[model samples]
Target: MMGRTIFIDPGRCIGCQACVSACRECDSHRGKSMIHLDYPDEGRSVASLPTVCMHCEDPVAPCAEVCPADAILVTPDGVVQQADTTRCIGCANCVNACPFGVPKIDLQAKLQMKCNLCYDRTAYGLAPMCATVCPTGALFYGTVEELRAERPGVQVADSFTFGTTTVSTGVAMVVPADKVQWPVPGGLPVVEINGKDVR
Candidate 1:
């Protein structure tokens, strides 16, 4: 069965950390927040990048491949799950192998922690806690058809390249419809500000 997926638009994030707080309230996580809210650039704090587990589809999953105990598994519906603590030996292999840096080993619990897309809730046709409490519409949970209709000008891409390997992710990103031209000039005009021209 195809399940509802989560989508993120970093531009819409205000760094309020409501998603992070909500993630902690997930019953499956045991008071741990799986989501990581970060500033992509320390100097440029205009936007926040919320890091999530991008359940890779193609190339299978790197975390699953490197697991010696078969701890990490991707569900049929494409949710890359947190490690099975019973089988997991706290080897930290999954922490190093994931391209998106999604998994982290809990030193105290000796287990891995990461986002499972709120499987406990999504399995019941309910949205994840993070998506449900987002103050700004930055985080969302919906069908692909609904996303396409909601964001007509953005392309949803799930694939990315890390080193020589191409990883396919289940979560899609909203990219501009037109190919991006980088190194574009800043939006500041050349004018005398305090007797100095701002470049």
Candidate 2:
């Protein structure tokens, strides 16, 4: 899976929760789903976005950097893995440091968990479970060229600017063909839906 990566298209998501369910089936985090469905406007609308680890690249993964116990690990392919249960101190440093807000601290288990892109399967040349079950193609796994050929009207983006800090990631986001970066106002993370940007 050298060049393959997960592509998220929020506009196409149907909020079916298929990805979340499938994620839990992975061997790494059995019985617990690392993927989260975020409803930007909970009461008003059903518009939901699937949130997964971006696997930060520019600063080399803030989650891994702030891990005092060195529980977090990054693969050579740039997939930021979930924390090591044996080493994790349950300090929530990675959870707070992640700009995408993907990590979850299991208080009872006292462990940090997040998506590893299903490394157990991906390493064997298989698509991630979440991407495999996504009905709306909101979460897809493939190379950039494959995505471009499959959906020519959209473009892929991997870099995002949060406040003044710009971060690149292993996963790519499928955005409108005309734009690459959607500026975040006041440093708050924003998500694009129906061609409009929203927080």
Candidate 3:
């Protein structure tokens, strides 16, 4: 199954809430609003980047492991998905479980919420609304394999931040061969170096 991940560059994000508005407008979501505009900082009102469910590929996903209600599941493509609210008791165990803090609670439905990566839109052969609406060409959408093939030598700041990530986050980001800041943690890691997978 194609994971249908949404990729965004924080440095590149223009802080447009188009993705947020589109998710609500699409209206496939039955229980809760799927996406939200997020801010990395609170003091100065900086360019808050858009963040949603990461859909991690790890076998021991934090959300699924911690959910008392088993509200979250990992798809083959590594997308984290929320379970049906009918089975959900609104305990918020999953909400606390995410290290990245992606899940949101729907005050009206009294259920937890996160993005499904616009399964409906992709099904109809359209780009994710936010990626489409990005005026700065910051946010990107594609397969992990595809991204790796395109960019190399970039490093993840978070992987280094947390002891060692088991390829913890699989989504690959591109930094120009002559760029300033790396995407995730620091610089982009080369998925393949010299036409060979880095060991």
Candidate 4:
């Protein structure tokens, strides 16, 4: 059973960086989390993926399998967290194994860390702080099946309204369009107008 996969709709990220603060709000994700922003885009309202540990379906746990210390452990909810402290030699092997680059070595703490996904909040049926703090209602949370079910035929997005306008004026844009195509990359919605994939 997949607990809840954290969904990142880049069209919703305004580059506000508020989620960074949200990660630090509680002890769950407070200490040197693996979650991080990457390679800032030059375009206004540039889209960025908050990359972190995307727990895989494979049997060989990538990070844990690579770790000599056996530092990574997969939780019941599918969140992989640090498991072994005594065995950790801080070789940074697991850090490199993560494809999303979700593991970080806390130089201060001298251990690897990443986002715990606010285990405490999710236990009570509350949204994670980052999703809650998202001003644009973009960083949403829910079961994958539920989220996929919620928008089956919902028109995804309208082409004329959000399609060209936001891209035209230049984007200090709040709530960036998913993309110009009805489905850009993440299988989300975007509108294609004229020559541009105006999102």
Per TM-score, the best of the predicted structures is 2
lDDT of 4 by residue, 116-178 (tens): 666678767887777778776456566545545763422122112222321111001122334
**Residue 160 shift from truth in candidate 4, angstroms:** 31
Model 1 TM-score, all chains together: 0.84
Candidate with the greatest lDDT versus the true structure:
2
- Candidate 1 weakest ten by summed lDDT: 179-188
Deviation in Å, model 3, residue 5 alpha carbon = 3.0
- Candidate 1, residues 4-23, lDDT tens digits: the string is 68777777888899999999
Computed on alpha carbons, the lDDT of every model, listed in order, comes to 0.76, 0.86, 0.58, 0.55
Rank all candidate structures by their TM-score, best first, as comma-separated numbers.
2, 1, 3, 4
Off by over 4 Å in 4: 1-3, 29-33, 43-45, 145-199
Displacement of residue 3 (Cα, Å) in model 1 is 5.2
Give the higher-TM-score candidate: 1 or 2: 2
* Colliding residue pairs in candidate 1: none
lDDT of 4 at 98: 56
How far off is residue 72 in model 1, in Å? 1.2
TM-score of each: 0.84, 0.89, 0.68, 0.66
Q: In candidate 3, where is summed lDDT lowest over 10 consecutive residues?
A: 155-164
True-structure Cα RMSD, model 4 = 10.3
Off by over 4 Å in 3: 1-4, 30-33, 41-45, 123-125, 144-167, 170-199
Q: Count the backbone clashes (under 3 Å) in each candidate.
A: 0, 0, 14, 4
